[model samples]
Target chain A: MHDTTDQHLFERVLQDNDQLADENRHHFDDMGAYVVNFMSAPGAGKTTLILELAKRLKDKLSVSVIEGDMVGDLDAERLRTAGVSAFQISTGRSCHLDAAMIARLLHATPHPEGQMIIIENVGNLVCPAEFPLGEHLRIVLLSVTEGDDKPIKYPVIFHNCDAVVLTKTDLIDHVDFNFETVEKTVKALNPKVELFKVSTKNGDGLDEFLAWLEARHSITLTASAV
Target chain B: MHEAAVALAILKRAVAAAEASAQKEEKAYAETAENTAPIFDVVKIVVQVGEFRNIDAESLEFTFSALRKEFPRTQNTELELINIKAIALCSLQNHQFHPEPANYFSCTICGGGIQNLISGKELDIVNIEIEQCLTETAA
Candidate 1:
């Protein structure tokens, strides 16, 4: 091996990732499905919110979930129990799932026919935000337990997201979460991002969230039909 | 941190360039002894680290130093980091926004508040400077 030829190695690394990104986009388009990459910190209620959404929209919309975690198939199991088709992706030592990983996972699992696919990214407010998985929309979750300053602290995730979900809203009374402050911070990061405040246990504001999903699905269907 | 990864990438590039320059100089030195001259004294690598990228300058420097040690050709080279500030443009407010000091604003038109993060979130190697040795003129 030539010692000075190491420069080509750098180009190869970047090129490999770029190719993976392209393949992911192609798969997403070929399936004629809209993918939503769900990102948030730990205990942000991503799984619970997804289960709730699946329960509500499963009959009307074909829903599938791709659960990502360092280990354990608990999230996929939870979705299956909720009557939603699910696949688990255990990343092992990886902090964030890249497009290459997702592309391989999609190949292993059967694609949902003309359905909406949700990828629950590893519970990270940072690294996952930097890598794009060819998802149509990026949704970020912030629970009441996390504090109102989360949007300000993890601004990159908030800024890149198409929508922000305030989960575990039922605990607002128990926790010191200031809705006004959180809203102010979120709006400051993304002026046009759709905001949804939801509670899976109490069934509060869930209808609005479901309506938003249906509206987005309808738009995608219409656009694809044309 | 991701910046450490980025710095490693930069260091590899710099070392590669230095090796190439050294090779060219060696070739010239063999062909004409009179033209034997130093290719460059030092190489300056300018990188822009942005706040949005969440890269720690100190961590990047440390990582770069460690990686540079592996490249003997770039042992004497210097790594220069130039941070590029980040700015956010709020569609609601129709204004250029900055985040230093961390200020948030509310839009008057739609009553929607906006936060304009102005600094941090940049990761790039903007340019590099190389020093060339001068040749002596014969009288």
Candidate 2:
């Protein structure tokens, strides 16, 4: 053991994650599937929103979900029951689902090609933003009950997301949630991020959200056609 | 929560790179790289911690300290984290400032709307201090 003190610029920590994410992207591109990674804090109603989306787009496009949780296939089962092909990825103790996990799941479960893969990331705000699951869209759900300052408090997730969905709007009037503040904060954080407010319970604001999704899904359809 | 996995990733990546370097050395110089590689002991790891990343340095350090022993080379490695302050830049005012007490960030200077992020999301190893075995070569 020759001991010499030498400081070497060895690695940037997330480079391996980036490589795997790239591989996931290449796989999606090859399969002609547009992947969307959905993230939110626990109880922010990500699953509810997903269920609503599946209900709306069931016939418009081929859709599937990769449910990521620390444990249980409850979400996957729910999605399957809701009439969408769903795959479960139990991350065990891992907080966030990495690209390698997605790649492995894709290889293992043969979902219909050209179907959109909506990855419902583990219910955490912080870690999921750091990981890119090779998704074309990164959608972050911020429920009204979680407070409006979430965009500022949890800035990275809000800033990094391609789209922001304000879920559980049915509780807006019942709670002290200031929609104005959330909107202002979101705009302040990321001007480019598309904002959609929806109540999965009432099906309110589902049209606009579904339209946005259909537009994105159409990109895959066009690409596949080409 | 993610810190443990992150610590593990750091060790895994460092060890993998060291091994790859050793192999390349063995192949290239026939024996020089291998001879100079010593034992692939990682002495210190410097990770740039960004405020926006939401990873607590204390938590990461604790995790790294606890998990380093699991790996071959990182048993005694010191994990050094450089805290990169999260900067909030107001696009309207064309200004950037550290969001002090930084939660619920707004432009500290001007009350601008767009808080454009300049930096502080880094998740990379800035540098690594390792034990390198040096030897005299045919000059």
Residue runs of model 1 more than 4 Å from their true location after superposition:
A1-19, A109-114, B1-45, B63-79, B90-93, B105-121, B128-139
What lDDT is obtained when candidate 2 is compared to the true structure? 0.79
**Candidate 2 local lDDT, A1-226, one digit each (tens):** 4654454664668777889999988889888788888999999998888888877777776788889999999999998887778889999989999988987887884743546778899999998988888988899998989987778677778878888999999998878888877777776677677899998888889899889988987876697688
lDDT of 1 by residue, A1-226 (tens): 1222212221321334457777887787778777888999988999999888888877777888989898999999988987888888898876677787888877774744447888999998977876778787889999999998888778778878889999998888899988888777777667778999999889998999878877887897688788
Residue A81, candidate 1: C-alpha displacement in angstroms: 3.8
Between which residue pairs do clashes occur in model 2? A12-B125, A13-B124, A13-B125
Fnat of each candidate: 0.17, 0.69
Residue A191, model 1: lDDT of: 75
Best by DockQ: 2
Docking quality category of candidate 2 according to DockQ thresholds = medium
Model 2 chain B worst lDDT window (10 residues): B30-39
TM-score for candidate 2: 0.88
Q: Write candidate 2's Cα lDDT for B1-139 as tens digits.
A: 8888788888887677556655555545545543333345677878888777878788998989999888877778888888887777776787887654253355667756445667787787876666645433433
